[model samples]
Target: MGSFEFLLDGIVRAFELIVTLNPYILSITGVSIKVSGTATLLAAMTAIPLAFALSFVQFRGRHAVITLVNTGMGLPPVFVGLFVFVMLVPAGPLGFLNRIFTPEAMIIAQYILITPIITGITLSAIKAVPEPIIETVYTLGGREKDVVLTTLLEARFGVITAVLAGLGRALAEVGAILIVGGNIAYTGSVGGIGEGLSYTRTLTTAITSETSKGDISTSIALGIILIAIYLFVNVAAGFFRRQD
Candidate 1:
């Protein structure tokens, strides 16, 4: 076949796989969504409050904390994966949770990987708020909670950007999830809290498997789906910002 014909054939095969809703493909996609979504939610929960505190409070080592957050922004996924793996080992303190190789473990890893990015970006956003506005709020006898809320409103767009950055990190991450969750599909026999939990398969893992198995068309299909999801997320974030 000519090069163009070969490309067309690959596209056709990928489309067939997608249309067929192959169980394996669907399973992987579902795991990816669950882990990424949970991670993002957890990161947001932790980071927002931490960022607000860092921005508004006068505490010792606050600068050090900010520096640590900035450093964490560049944390390597593989290293994070290794760290989580160790912590989840049988002798580890959290080992009793039996979370290793489960979706929850993957979520924890991704949460750790994304939380710092969110916190750092959010700190920047909060700090970008004008001192004048903060002072005015205080002058008006606004309580600390009111001051924080007003500052957040003024920096809403920046905060949203931080969230989007965290989402991007969560969605794109693979190594931490792979190591912590073992990238293994849950069989019916594995009983526990993680028994029915989605196993570690994700788009990245699916693509890796397909490529390793020489299923180029299937790998391409997963890649296309991953790209589409990322784009959709970015567009959705934009819409939310515009609404705000």
Candidate 2:
């Protein structure tokens, strides 16, 4: 009974934090959106094109390339994070840019993690496109570029789904970003929310942090928002799917 009451109380306070727009909560959410959004956007830009190429072009080692992409889709986030960390450290070859422990580094980590996922899914979608579509394009004297565009049009829904899937994965990711971003927050109060507002902290990381600190309300608040955001992404995906 006591435990139940405590959970109920925590939930109520969580709602309060959400309703009142707590700065710490909003800051965390914003970082989550910004980093994931940017990384997913960049990934979509590159992955969609790459998928189209993989589907349209016949080149030496193309099968090997596809296999590599498929393998990358399952790469462990923690392992990717460690790889990025090693590269970003001052002594590493790419360390001169000094991107470690920053949002940029987090973006890079997430981009690496999701690019292959987007590419693989989109490639499968493109492959699933009917052969007649390409044949029809060629029969009409359409050029290679036209066939690519036509296939992309046919696979639009799948491409969108791929992007959303990547975004969902990015938003829910903690291990890579936590390692790369260091989950930093500002030191001083910025919005009178008691806790310092997040700088690099995100909803996933913040939930882990707050829960560890025994700040149940904050954790619950972040969780509620995270669930809501995920639902929104799913709903958007469903809506696009229904359009086909």
User: Which has the greatest lDDT?
Assistant: 2
Model 1 compared with the native: what TM-score? 0.89
Give one digit per residue, the lDDT tens place, for model 1 in 156-239: 888888888888888778788888877786555322212232368888876776678877777777787788888998898789
**Cα lDDT, model 2, residue 137:** 97
Residue range 144-175, candidate 2, lDDT tens digits:
99999999999888888899889989999999
Write down the TM-score of every candidate: 0.89, 0.94
lDDT of 1: 0.82
Which parts of model 2 are misplaced by more than 4 Å? 190-193, 240-244
- Model 1: residues with Cα > 4 Å off, grouped in runs: 1-6, 186-198
lDDT of each: 0.82, 0.91
